[model samples]
Target: MAEVVGPRLYSCCHCRNHVALHDDVISKAFQGRHGRAFLFSHALNIMVGPKEDRQLMTGLHTVADVDCSDCRGVLGWKYERANEETQKYKEGKFILENLNIVKENW
Candidate 1:
């Protein structure tokens, strides 16, 4: 019989709390505060902090910090609103730093 397999996931590096599913990944070419980041369609086990406008490489956008609910460690930010029409597609997306997350069940 074929072995059972579970959904692939990304976990918080600090506390091993599952944060995102591999299927939810939108893009992996995003830039984060530290370095490489990934844009995810959805995130789990996280908390969204206060929203504020910040100027990013693409343009000005309102975003909220995302933290791990279990460890309270800052994972990245979520785009609340995009100022430019071309960047509007990024709104409501979550960016998680590569350094802050580890792959699980790969």
Candidate 2:
């Protein structure tokens, strides 16, 4: 069983929000996902996606291929459509910890 440690520090530049998850919620979510019977996980796919893009000019945009989960629009991955192993890893981390979901759109 992996220990549920709080995030040391997480800040969303776009949203300007930094907070941690409640221990109770973290514990519950962890237990529900941590098991040998079945496992699912979410990962930082810094590849091509809808979120990763920037306007270079009026009619131009740019996107890069890097492992930076926060590279412009490199949001996280979805578990259901993803493979089994990926889903398993998704269990270990919280959604908020992985991406900026509830933060402001800075």
Best by lDDT: 1
RMSD of each: 1.9, 14.6
Assess every candidate by TM-score.
Answer: 0.95, 0.22
Give the per-residue lDDT of model 2 (tens digit) for 1-106.
6664544333333443443323312322322111211111322333334323333222222323222344354222222221244344332333332333222212
Each prediction's total of clashing residue pairs, residues at least 3 apart in sequence or on different chains, is: 0, 11
Off by over 4 Å in 1: 1-4
The worst-scoring run of ten residues by lDDT in candidate 1 lies at 1-10
Cα error, residue 52 of model 1, in Å, equals 0.4
Where model 2 places Cα greater than 4 Å from the true spot, the runs are 1-7, 19-82, 85-87, 91-106
Please report the TM-score between candidate 1 and the true structure. Answer: 0.95
